[model samples]
Target: MKTETIGTATFETWTVAETADAFARDEIVLIDVRTPQEYMFEHIEGALLMPLSFFKAGKLPGQSDKRIVFHCGSGVRSERVCRAAIEAGITQIAHMEGGFAAWKAAQQPYIGTNMATGAPQRAPA
Candidate 1:
């Protein structure tokens, strides 16, 4: 985890491994801030979809009770989401460092498209 502060807000960047472990232990609220189409194609299991196109910082779930960790396709949009949260008074924010790409590169299990049937399948492969 790496922490960065800007203005009066501070945010943390978590590696894919760290995010996965915390998510498995139910220690964080993992949010997928990518497009709905992207999420439908493949995403981490149990990740909440709050597409950046329609993200409302004020609507963050468990903002005060749980650690909200945001992730996007490649970390760009998620970082933007983090800024939005800070602007909305959400101080304790975190985002996956390399996003979904890194997660897959790390070979973490996720809901992936089964090309054979074009259906979502658990991909530990």
Candidate 2:
């Protein structure tokens, strides 16, 4: 992981392969920083929506062991969220490289459309 300091906070970046592997192993919390509409259109399985517009630091899931991986349509929003998370005292944080687009380009499996909305879904409760 490469570290970056934005202001006084530090964050890391992870490649699509790395993030995917972590997800498959249940070793990370995937946060999608896109709007609910975008998320409903397509998103990685098990990813929780934490849209940048309404992201709340206190609401992030507490995970001491599993890594927190944030992602967006193309990574920009996720980077913003990562910085916020770091400032909020989240120590283990990372954003996916190229974001969801890269994940899809890699042919990774994701949930979307009717499959994703067949059952009502909301951000983490």
Candidate 3:
């Protein structure tokens, strides 16, 4: 895939399988850039909660050298977050092509939290 720079960050989009492979190899960081409510509803396995609002507020944490992958309900918000990350001087980042919906559609496992119980549930296979 061709690498592009939105600001200071360099990002490359990827398919769900490619993202899974990267995660398996521990080569990338999966960041869920959706709202808290959406994240609580469902999200990719092992994804870190770094809402777009946090990025906008300039409170995102982590190393710039790590390969960061941003995702949301759809690719739109994540794309915006990716751009913001670039503007914040993060150099390595990317967005999932279709976001969490695509990941679930691809039969990838995800974590679903029970709002009432505050318990985490894994997507059934």
* TM-score of model 1 (CA atoms): 0.95
What TM-score against the true fold does each predicted structure earn?
A: 0.95, 0.82, 0.79
For model 3, how does the per-residue alpha-carbon lDDT over 1-125 read when each residue is reduced to its tens digit? 45886655578787888888888888888888888888878877788988877765255556555677778887888888877767777777688988898988988888887667978988854
lDDT of 2 by residue, 1-125 (tens): 67887666558899999898889999998989999999887778799888899998878877777878899999899988887787888765789989988888888888756564476433221
Tens digits of per-residue lDDT for model 1, 1-125? 89999787789999999999999999899999998999999999999999999999998765666799999999999999999999999878999999999999999999999999998899886
Full ranking by lDDT? 1, 2, 3
Q: Return the top candidate by lDDT.
A: 1
So what's the TM-score on candidate 2?
0.82
Better of 1 and 3 by TM-score: 1
Report every candidate's CA lDDT.
Answer: 0.92, 0.83, 0.79
Worst 10 residues of 3 by lDDT: 56-65
Q: Give the clashing pairs for model 2.
A: none
Which lDDT value does model 3 have at 63?
A: 54
Residue 104 accuracy (lDDT) in model 3: 87
